[model samples]
Target: MNKSVFILPVIVILIAAILSSIFIVDEREKVLVLRFGRVVQTIDEPGLNFRIPLMDQVVTYDDRIISIDMAAQEVIPSDDRRLIVDAFARYRIVNLERIRQATGAGGDQAIAIADQRLENILNAETRTVLGEVTSGDILSTDRDALMLRIRNAAIAEASALGIEVIDVRLKRTDLPSQNLERTFERMVSERQREAEDERARGREAATRITALADRTVVELESDASREAQIVQGEADASRNAVFAQAYGQDTEFFEFYRSLEAYREGLATGNARLVMTPPEDFFDYLRSPNGNVAE
Candidate 1:
């Protein structure tokens, strides 16, 4: 019984000793071994790792990229316009030794320190770069280029703290309430003026077209009137020519005929009175029984 008790205690002690010496370093984690509170070696691979049990210590750090969402900061533009700017950054640990030296050990404190550093860098750099641009530039076409420049500057600034900034993005950019309302009003007025100008131009065009149409109508009517007058004058001249030709064919009859026509026209006029003697030449043609006047 005494021998078995001694053997069981020995086995238990050996197992405890093995468990204390052996430590696991996961694939996604990096372990730093410290001797006398000073970092001696860093184990970056997975599987079993041997340490000096109670004398040596292991410090683990996550090898994954971390995201930090910065709070909104009020920034001023070159035009003296105030805007709220919100941004975020993606960073990862690049140098484990530098991270340990800067943050000391691990946990929330290290993350807080790194975040503070990143925020300071972002604030300082953004202010300097963003201050050079006017409010219009911020709200217009150059915003993307400005963002890229700021991101690159921020990455460089944060690199010395063992924080490798993978990407930086601006989430929101807002003008002040007063500025927004004023801008909206101005835009509305501009659109209204443009619409009014378009309407005026349309009216002017319509008037011009109407006047041209009226002028054309008047010209056509005048041309038709002139053509009608010319046709009537031609028809009258043709009738007169036909009568003249018929009269020229018989001279004596034409003279007798013209004398009778003249007498009838003269008597038909109410302003004249006809009183003729019976033996007069003008009445001789009427009195003669053979229808011939004496010489």
Candidate 2:
């Protein structure tokens, strides 16, 4: 009866020991076995694992991709322009053994340490790479290329911490408020200068147009005066020709008509002086239809 009781306790103790020695690894976990606080084995696959109980320590880490939200950092480009950069990253532990060896801290503690180191690397590399480009590059599609450079640089640095940087992305980029105000002021000044130049050009063109119009007016007035003189000469010539024709057709009637015209012009006023009459001049034409000399 004492042997049966002792065997039952022994069997229970063996079962407990076996259960303690054996460990389960989930597919989502990476099991790291440490011996005397030193890494001995790294198991990434999901299955049963064996370890020395009480002497062996096991630590699990997420084998899946992890994301890091990088805080906003200021960077200065080659153009001496300052910018605020907000970025994020995708990373994973590519070497669990190396990670445990370096930190000896597992789980959330390891992740936190790695995150702090990666953030430093990310910020430094971001500053180094972006500092080689211009501020315009940050605000443009060229930032995609710049980010690729930062990712490559970050991956190189993060390898030291057993973290593989998968990708780096920029969430936002902007100039400082003071820079924005300065840029706006400069743009306004440029526009104002351009406006002034345009107005000056317009004024110059208007002056030229007005001068051309004045010249045209002077030319037109001179042309009209010349044409008026020509018409008056032509009319006078026509009237003299008519008079000559009438004189040639009938000499007596021409003389009589000419004398009557002279009398009417000379005697238009009541006080008109006429020293010659009758015998002295053909004055008889005033009373006779046909001009004749007074006896």
Best-performing candidate as measured by lDDT: 2
Prediction 1 global C-alpha lDDT: 0.82
- Give the Cα-based TM-score of candidate 1 against the true structure: 0.71
Model 2, 11-100: lDDT tens digits are 999899899999999988898898888778889899999999898998999888999999999999999989999999999998988787
- Regions more than 4 Å wrong, model 2: 204-295
Worst 10 residues of 2 by lDDT: 286-295
CA shift at 185, candidate 2, in angstroms? 2.6
Clashing pairs in 2: none
lDDT of candidates 1 onward, in order? 0.82, 0.88
lDDT of 1 by residue, 107-210 (tens): 45677888888888988877878899987787675477887778789876677777788877778889877789997899999999999999999999999999
